[model samples]
Target: MESLPEETSSSSSTTTSGGGVGCGGAGEKLPIRPPIQPPSEKYSPLDWSAYFDQESDVFIPESENVFHVYTAGKEGPVVFCLHGGGYSGLSFALAARKIKQEARIVAMDLRGHGKSSTENDLDLSIERLCGDVLAVIKTMHGDSPPAILLVGHSMGGAVAVHVAAKKVLPSLAGLIVVDVVEGTAMASLMHMQKLLSNRMQYFPSIEKAIEWSVKGGTLRNIDSARISIPSTVKYDDSKKCYVHRARLMETEQYWRGWYEGLSEKFLSSPVPKILLLAGTDRLDRALTIGQMQGKFQMVLVRHTGHAIQEDVPDEFAITVLNFISRNRIGPNGVEIPGLRRPMQSQQ
Candidate 1:
């Protein structure tokens, strides 16, 4: 195993510009509108049991927040997934479905997003997010923990880096960071902010929400968007409309320093890591294929955007599986024998 780096200074600030809308794709022009207020009547809690094979909430007593976790597959190495900003655990639902038979998949909705409870303000911090992830790992593994793999996207990728840097999970096998990297450009960050800022807070119907999502250009994969958008919203009894469950303002505030912090954490991580970059040009050029050659593995998924898994589910799953198989360390932190799978050609 690689040794962790020494503790470093806190993250630095970056200049930000605000203009235009949409995450990475172009969309139709919509009328400017104010955000919709929360409903007067309490929201009807979503019953995900019917949608996912296993859906349950794990209460983190330390933070006093209940994290919604969705799991599939009865056995194999545990694969814990963390979704990006404004997304829920269901963001990985499609990919999870494809790899469930090979691994026990667990995806969680971070605090203030999806079905997770946002009861405390402490839940919004990066440290607390790392704590929540550790609690889940400890709870799931119990006395005998197997080699675990962490797969994260965007903001969640930062959280994963922090957790790995902390060295909390003794059974941790590898880290797979999607799209996000150490030196993300300010322009890209500003674009994401504009995209979130321009999003409609509520929709009159689920169909309308899907239509708006498609027109808004937040997601490239229409099928993935259709599944994820509905999962991120809940019907409001009083308003008779669907509203987003994520707290976008709070998330965006923390995202300002997320990249810098992730850089620090990445430098200190001891586990084998894989950085998956979308083949799009919108993301800033920071770390290159030549730079990470021996330190860590990097793969570029051609023609995909920030949401690599959603944009190319099968390819993403195969990439993850290949990485895990290649880096399957045992409980004592030694390489596992006779369990490796043959590598498939990269797409």
Candidate 2:
């Protein structure tokens, strides 16, 4: 129900919250995702908007999903980043800039969220969601120097995992998945996404509405157990209501088949990788940091939730950087940590 921005060439497209074309039927063009580069001689502007330009697109030949890409560290390999729920590629601006300033980090807002436009096509399937990321890989075909590192948080983290499973990414040095617990089963997550969406629905007119969100905080019943995040709010005096900076459909689509067989997908990844998760969110921390199984390494961060990257950017960035710096199968493989039960394992 939101208006679509004017369409552009796959590489020229800008960011959007919903329907944007990608390599798949999603519409945006996609390029093969390259690897991270070394540091640059000088720093590029780290400020979100200033650092990013609507430059060359990474399009997928199959679908039209376009990820508005901004590059940094023209010197090193590439780091392909996927953002969390409702956040655009800009969410990584601060941390990406601070982390090894010269590294070329590419951040993208996946479909139905951030700057991607999901107007023409509706792909609520996890496979389709991953196709958007695939668009980036197909475009690069291997121009990178160092290696490609995939980092994703929450939904984006899921996308990173889906792609890492495929052997196509040989340059994939490592993977970093934030705040997600695998094997919980998709149906349970779908229900939770629905409950949260129902709670955050915006009113037709904020002026006539009893409550509205603000920059520092959101309007809500103090007693409500639900959690919230901080965001910049804009109130149009003419309209007499508050408009959230995030896209509406993004809020609604969180559970729309986000995990269509995701468990199976993780088990199917081509290589074992690293996982970073939150200790707070019951869902994220449900499983203990398991033993590293030569294929997978897991780390735990306390005091965070589903959106750990935004809640604590510096720590999140460091965790991911650390993983990429050490992308390898240890002699002992991965040492799975002890579990904090009622948590389950992949048996």
Candidate 3:
């Protein structure tokens, strides 16, 4: 569901002590790397204390995407923003725009999604995509540790977990996971595969492409009568047919590996957090098959859907604010029972 991120040329990197998690190849097995010391102090801790002041504004973006990367808020702590599938940093623009009034916000267009690239050639693996996020943060830090917050939704949420677990992100003030779970890596892979198989056939023109895309997909559920076209999707006039502005194919690969799984060592690392689920989620626990073992807090978004931001942004925003107020750090947060729909909800 995401747009494409511009393809980045990777720097040569060999596993080092505390080199963070190993980047697994597509359909390739990854070897474990030993944990290393934090990066240089320049990148060690982010100074979040200053951003709390009101009157933050958007600065020029630091990325090279089709859309501008929004950096807003005052001089204080920084927060990196990650959006859900098929969307871009624009998805968080509205909410984070407000948060900017109090702190700095750096919202990223996930690689291959949202203005990064134009191909729907998606790779839905967790490991690579998660690495993309960390790479961006590292680029921003330039070898400095500054305190910051991460607001990740759905797929973005899973990426957040894997990054935070690495403990390589210095001065991460807090983590806010929006409606994501451990098994998400697996679920996203299946979802993306079906989506790609069904709608990936490209059209000669943009109009025809978007037309066909609209006929299928979660887009049909938009209830056009009430829902506005999400910012994530926009018609590309230059092309006669609609083309996903995001890179669909590479994204697919990132999530594919994710579902296969990331290192278990990270599950315990992301603490001081919150989880927002939708009351409407109907995933079957039995079919999920695996057991959810660990600790984390969970809250249902009253009457929301899988895309909490799109379905009920207000509630989602409120819950996030509450989590920020109640637990910025310290206790990490609560681990709710694994998400599973009851027989009744299914009916």
The candidate that wins on lDDT is 1
User: Per-residue lDDT for 1-347 in model 1, tens only?
Assistant: 12223334432332123424522224444444443323221122334443357888887655567778998877777778999877888777778767776777789988778788856633467777887788776666664467778889988888888877776576677888888876663446768767666779778877667656545655666567666777777898988899876767656666666666565566456667788887545333335543354657778887666788877888888887787677764323334222232234489
lDDT of each: 0.69, 0.51, 0.51
**How would you encode candidate 2's per-residue C-alpha lDDT over 1-347 as one tens digit per residue?**
12223323343444434545434446655554443332221111123544433335565555556655655555454677787655556556555655545356777756655445544334545667676676666575433223667788767777787776654554565577776655543535546656546654443442322223222122222111011211222355666654544444444453545545554555445544566766533332223333333346667776544555555667866776666456542211232232111223368
At residue 219, give the lDDT of candidate 3. 31
The numbered model that scores best in TM-score is: 1
TM-score of 3: 0.58
Q: In model 2, how large is the Cα lDDT of residue 28?
A: 57
Candidate with more favorable, higher TM-score: 2 or 3: 2
| Model 3: worst 10 consecutive residues (lDDT sum) | 220-229
**Candidate 1 TM-score over all chains jointly:** 0.74
Clashes of each: 0, 72, 86
Q: What is the lDDT of candidate 1?
A: 0.69
* Candidate that beats the other on TM-score, 1 or 3, i.e. the better one: 1
User: What ranges in model 3 sit over 4 Å off?
Assistant: 1-68, 117-127, 184-188, 197-239, 247-253, 262-266, 280-294, 328-347
**Models sorted by lDDT, best on top:** 1, 2, 3
